[model samples]
Target chain A: MNLPKSVSIIEVGPRDGLQNEANFITTEIKKEFIQHLVCAEIKEMEVTSFVSPKWIPQMQDAAELIQSCYSSIRSIVLVPNKKGAERLLATNCKSAAVFVGVSNRFNQKNINKSTRESIVEIRPIIADLKSKGFFVRACISTAFYCHYEGAIATADTLALCQEFADAGVDELSVADTIGMATPAESFSLFSTLKQQLPNIMIAAHFHDTRKMALANIYAALQAGIDRFDTSAGGLGGCPFVPGATGNVATEDVVYMLERMNIKTGVKLDKLVKAIDIIAPHLSRKIDSGYYQLTKKRDISV
Target chain B: MNLPKSVSIIEVGPRDGLQNEANFITTEIKKEFIQHLVCAEIKEMEVTSFVSPKWIPQMQDAAELIQSCYSSIRSIVLVPNKKGAERLLATNCKSAAVFVGVSNRFNQKNINKSTRESIVEIRPIIADLKSKGFFVRACISTAFYCHYEGAIATADTLALCQEFADAGVDELSVADTIGMATPAESFSLFSTLKQQLPNIMIAAHFHDTRKMALANIYAALQAGIDRFDTSAGGLGGCPFVPGATGNVATEDVVYMLERMNIKTGVKLDKLVKAIDIIAPHLSRKIDSGYYQLTKKRDISV
Candidate 1:
């Protein structure tokens, strides 16, 4: 396929992939992962999160991981509320991502709060993040569907996006947490989200559990939204969300977009090389059809 | 990902996957691969091609490969034209598929015939198949892009598709040969194809070279198209087409669609069980991220 001249790769393996690994993966190794990402010519990375270990053990060392990493690339962190935002205040990371679920059931399951309650709670945190002159993004989860509650309504999702925008978030991330979306849903939602909130720059977060992550990205692109969150090797799919498999593999996404003449700004050979550096670290083989297929035989053997 | 109630697994490994492999897998091994696909619970299979042995040594043994098979599943062979279709007339295979390329350059490169010439050649062949009461399908290739020519116009694709529909082919299959399509393009194409040809069923054949296969499938589904073509273990991509990697994995597609609560009529546990029979003989590791990530520990080790 003829791809666009360039596209962006927002690396999320450090925060999304590592967050669910069974092994602790010391903060240093986490640093190595980030280091290799940079060596691969990556310009943006979601390094870690500021959250209590009680909720997720994988992210317990987020603060430490970020502290150890030294790079010019933009580093984004996940912050749940004002307390989490306050904790990131001391870190030098340039961006903070605040999340709220659009589906009521997902909000309750993800953060132990109602959709409205989570929106109200995350708003001030967003304001606080903006006040600090940091790039603040509101990640709207289950904006597509919720496993517990089934399909999410457009009205409910729109209200949450408006709240995030009104809260002064610099950017908005619409996510299909369960990978339950089709291109039609993504296109309509992204298009409507843009029409209503004309000022917000939108990024897309899709789960590949249903194998539609890349397609969702394509739909979002058609709706004129750019910026995407993808895991290296298609590495990250949330463990907390049952049936969810992985995010769109970074290399695969870059490959598809590039061939279609859409610019993803990702270096193909360099990204594949980065996957090589990561191959030995994990106990299991990484599953990216794109990598397994295109990888030169010498490396595969 | 939430899947539909079930999804159908169309095993294309033996025909599609092995076609590009440089290694000479003998007739005996080809039989074993077919058996393994059945073990994987694949309900429908495209097992072999009736093309000349001189051109494709990999598929030289159409008779032995088909005769040695031990399963009860329906099998179809791919025929480029009346000559290939004539070779398969004596077999009990019941069905065969002919291809039409949207790009003349690809058609000439692939079958040594121009796009219109290929269609003309296949029409009479399709008529003969009809007379014999054999089920036949016409696959339109390069519906999205071509290595030699980029971003094919929709009108050209539609004209080719209309030609096949007018010929009374039972189904229409659109392929993104080089992984060059996005969901918007897929949706738009599928919508237009379906609207123009209401009686004929539409199937999607995608390559994952640029990581947009699943996304394209999602778009087709949104456009209300079903009956997709996928490979066992995500085998086979068009090698001649640079940057193309593999077809969307059958297991991954099943997992995603089944979890979505759509009706695909495939069983996942049965599918995984089916793979055990041929996993060892596979020349390369399976190119599927979900299978690699969620592999049963015993097999992975």
Candidate 2:
């Protein structure tokens, strides 16, 4: 019952959401989607990633998309390496995100490197970003469970997060990458992180593969963490992770938070509208609960 | 973190799940479905309802279905009135469930009576059933939010549950009939109920309309609730409530419970098979998290 008074929603639909989409959405429509999210009052968002277009053709327009985003919002672009970080620096984006999976197998499969090697490579990148007065967000992927490695050790995840904290990253976005985390694990992990590293901002990112994303977010809230990374219309899944599905839907998160009397500074009606921009372009149906319910009412009316 | 070590799942797919299906499943199929649930080790089940065939023709074979179920499992039948109770009395079923809505408007629309009137009619029936040594479960519907009346008063729901407890019902199945209750509301209401009616067995029934059922269940668990009403493959919704969807899936519930180290005494893999018997006849797809994930894995393999 002792939940936070308010929480921040870090929208990731344009980046994490659309990255795995098989059908390529035009740059214009992606911009329109980001605009709708802005009008919904999303203060922070991962607009796109600066990774190689060969890896994720869906994100080929990353630079063009990030350049078109509203400067008023904190637009974050994922940086996979020094080259990706350089690409981010070329753009007007002030916030950059880096990722390292806790599991060695997942890390190797994702970026052809071990967990230790990835951390070693990214440590200087984060420090350099901080020195350049840029906001750095370390995306700790597979923090709770990995698709290849199974249930991750809490100690290993905490150690990886501590490495990012020491690297002067402004925030840490810990993810339940395969969506296999229970609320108990979410509470236990986040509680320790919050207690151990009290000053750094921490955001809980969850996938909806098992439909426990909202429940996980609720547990994180109870653990005294207020920031969340959500995708619009519950779009996006990890292409590298087999059976992985969408991120927790943005509209659903806002609805749950506002109902609990916790302010998110995001408009539900407008947020739902944002999903409409990209829903038709995708191969999958908009399966987010709130979005489907809204469409049902639309059809019934 | 102070969760119960074990929980009981009351399978309601037979009655609550199939009652709304437009297609009439054969009596033999219904019996097979119940048999599969028994294989899953479901100790309690709401087998069928004894309502008029004109209202719910799918349950027209209620008596025949109940007679075919295993006597080892606790098979419950829904008895709406004196006539239904009389029908139940004719069978070997030992448990009977009766229901009343907390909202007067919802009550009037559902059964053409006010909440108080429905309660008055059911009070004597409950007493009679208790005298006959039949186990009685009072389903308090619209306990949190009503589709017709918007948000329901916590005080009104508590008072209705208290009336049922005093009527000597063995258990109370409190429900968010419209699938609109928040986790905070679930925790607060159940906390108060557990405090006030400490001796009466209370179970939480949630619909996955907004995909918040699991979160609400987690919250209810935090409030010390160890019993839940779930449907196989996430079947069932209130026929009278517009836009209401499936009950929380039993497999998904068992997955979450078992993952959190809380026992439900039900085999999830076998429980999933129970859905196969009824899935083909359902109007909607089996959209429960765990069920869909299993199907996805099946397709991939």
Candidate 3:
């Protein structure tokens, strides 16, 4: 029953959410989506990623999205390397995120490097961002279970977190990349991380592939970790990791937290509206329970 | 995490799951669905409900289903009143479930009686069944919240449980009829129910309306309640309760329990196959997350 009075939700629909879509969403529509989120009082968001357009065609308008929109709130963009970091630095955004998979096989497949090599590559990027007075978040992907490598050792994930902490990252996010994490794994992993690294801030990122995302988020909350990465309309999935679904829905998370008397500072009705704005643009159907429930209400009423 | 080594799953698909379907599924298909669940090692199931065909045309073949399909497992049937119980007596099924909404407003709308009046009607039914050596389970519907009544008082729900327990009901099922219960609410409610009625068995039943069903189940497990009422392929919703969706998916529950190293005595693969068997016969999409993932895997593999 012990939980934080308030939680910080980092909305990632524009970046992680749209990047996996089979269809292309126009830049104007992306900005409109971000505007909807901002209207709903989502202060922190990953607007877009600065990865190469050839790598992910869905995110081809990353630069255009940052330049045209993302002025009112704290916008965090994903930067894969120094090149992506350079592009992010050119934008008006001050916060940047970097990801490194804990499993070697996953890292090799995802980022084309071993865990050690990826860590080595991101160390200077973190230092450079810190020197520039920018907030850097290091995400440890596949922290619990990896589709390619199977179960990952906690020691390996923690060591990666240690590396990020040493490199002076402002915060760390543990991701259930393939959405295979159970509540027990979520609690134990996040608890161990919190206990080991008391100084570093921790965020939880989960996929709903196995329908344990919200449960994992609840478990993470019980472990004293508060910040979470969520997607509006449950819009994201891992293209590289087979069977990975969208992040836990933002409206669903907001609803649960608010009902429990926990503060999320986000309006549920407005969040649903935001989801409705972009729901038709996506190729896949929205997988959010709250979103679906809201639609049902609209029809019945 | 102090979870039970083996959890009991009472499958309610044949009754609760199919009752809300818009399409008419034949009794043959219903029996095949029950057989698939039995093949998946499900030992306890609610085969069908003995309600009026006029009330729920989908469950009109309840007697024929119980007579033909349920042989190897423990079968439970839903009986709304003494009349329904009379029909249940004609069948070979020895277990019957009766429900009353915890909220008076919900009970009045759902069953055409006040909460207390509904309890009064079921007391004689319980006495009649117990005298015949039947296992009677009393379900408190809308235990946490109600669509018409909004948030229900915990004291009111516990009082209803006391009434049922005093009436010699064998077990109690706390249902979130609208799926509005949060993790904290689920844990606190079930924990209080367990503490107040330590001798009586308690089972958690939830709808996934707000997508908190599994999270609520995880919370209930933390509160030391091991038995759950789950519907296969996440079927079943309260037709009277607007915006209420399916029950917590059985395959999803089994996946979480097995991954947490808790035994459910149910095979995940076999359960998915059971869902696959019935997936084509349904009018709506299969709402189970594990079932969706299995479909994706099927397409890819």
Q: Write the per-residue lDDT of candidate 2 for residues B1-301, one digit (tens) a residue.
A: 8989999999999999999999999999899899999999999999999999998999999888887556898899999889999998888888999999999999998888899999999999999999999999999999998887788999999999999999999999999998888889899999999999999999999998887888999999999999999999988998898788889999888999999999999998888888888788778899887888777752221
| Better by DockQ, candidate 3 or 2 | 3
Q: Which regions of candidate 2 are displaced past 4 Å? A: A298-301, B298-301
Best by TM-score: 2
Clashes of 2: 0
> Model 3, range A39-157, lDDT digits (tens) per residue?
99999998889888888888888888888546678899999988999998887789999999988998888878898898888889999999999988998899987887788988988
Consecutive 10-residue window with the lowest summed lDDT within model 1 chain A: A292-301
Best by DockQ: 3
Evaluated at residue B188, the lDDT of candidate 1 is 84
Candidate 1 C-alpha lDDT tens digits along B1-301: 2222334556677788778776777777677667766766676788998877777777888877777434477687899877788778877677778897899998888889998889778888888887888777788889978878877999999998889888878877788887767766887898888899999877888877656777777767767776888886777877556556678888777765665557666655656555544556666777565666456342210
Per-residue accuracy of model 2 over A172-273 as CA lDDT, tens digit each: 999999999999999999999999999999999999877788889889999999999999999888888877888999988898999999999999888878
- For model 2 the local lDDT of residue A197 reads 92
> TM-score of B chain for each model?
0.91, 0.98, 0.96
Off by over 4 Å in 1: A1-9, A26-29, A35-43, A53-73, A81-83, A102-121, A147-149, A297-301, B1-75, B79-87, B91-94, B98-204, B218-228, B231-246, B249-301
Candidate 1, what DockQ? Answer: 0.28
